[model samples]
Target: MDAIDPVVGFFGLGLVAGMLRSDLKLSSGLYDTLTIYLLIAIGLKGGFELASRDVTALMLPTIVIVAASAVTPMVAYQVLLRLGRLPHPDAASISAHYGSVSVVTFAVGASYLGRQGLDYDGYMSVFLVFLEFPALTGR
Candidate 1:
């Protein structure tokens, strides 16, 4: 019944399965199907909520999200290159990976917030799409 129970349970199950050398594995097609299902479900849910709201209301937050997405890669790339002493190409690759948002992480966080009875802007799904592009192209 805890907010993070599902997250903890799933993580623990994976850890236990791995440690036990279980043969549990998802087929590639099933994996892709699940991924696509999740993406479309989130997009449709977000879009439905978004449709009820005014675009101008989300503009400022969208701008901030996009700006952060753009800045994160630059900062990561610099840190990796200078502090980590990584080569240019390696640093850039790592930065791109770091800059992109993890959909699974976002889904878990959203679920946690919902379980805790907290309110978050539904437009966040739209923001996720916006955040991905800058990080990918920034490098």
Candidate 2:
């Protein structure tokens, strides 16, 4: 049972469905409901685990996480504006997208690590929540 087997299966199903022109589109309401459910589940799981840990111990890592979140957007904006020669607004918009964390990507990474019998800090979900705000507000 490979960790990525399910991921691959879902991707293949979507591809096959699209190629066959199947009428399998999700309704907007269903899509929104699923998204909300996923987010709530992730947040609750993380929060339940995080609640048992010492806040002081997580402080330094949280600071570093916040700093990285702040710095990444600025670096992205500069690269897009200077190297890509994009307009200011376009560069900023792209940078904001890069700065925010994708919960779906995080979930996939966590699944991969779990399959490999590896562990990450439980506080990472808190970091994801923090990372989302600065990118949007900073711009």
Candidate 3:
């Protein structure tokens, strides 16, 4: 109930962006630009974090979590497409984004938390890499 605004915004944005289906539309390009910015920003920030992290303590769990994040979307996409009757490509694309909490959000939240004097656990930084394992590999 508290999380419905963003969901509704997504549906509204999708509909507005869906208006032109003739292979290419103005809104489609805008959508693509927005998506690309999201992907690039997330990747760049994650790369920065990895660069600044201590490798010795981070190596093992980092490897496992990353693997999990990579695999979860495939399983999720399959489940959504098969059991949920979603179109394959569409399901996969959406599942990939949803399977992991966005790194961008985490980065911003961490910064705000820091400003508010909250110290975070070290392991939480690498948590995303391991998220897929539980969602995709667990019961």
TM-score of each: 0.80, 0.78, 0.48
Instruction: Using TM-score, rank the candidates from best to worst.
Output: 1, 2, 3
* Each model's lDDT: 0.83, 0.81, 0.64
lDDT of 3 by residue, 10-106 (tens): 5456567678543434587897887677556655655677777787877787777777676777788888899999887789778877676754466
Give the Å error, residue 138, model 3: 23
Model 3 reaches what TM-score against the true structure? 0.48
RMSD of each: 3.2, 3.4, 8.7
Least accurate 10 contiguous residues by lDDT in model 1: 1-10
Better of 1 and 2 by lDDT: 1
* Candidate that would win on lDDT: 1
> What does candidate 1's lDDT look like per residue over 1-139, in tens digits?
4354665456568779999999888899997996898789778878988999998988998889888888888999999999999999999999888788977777777777877799998768888888897855642
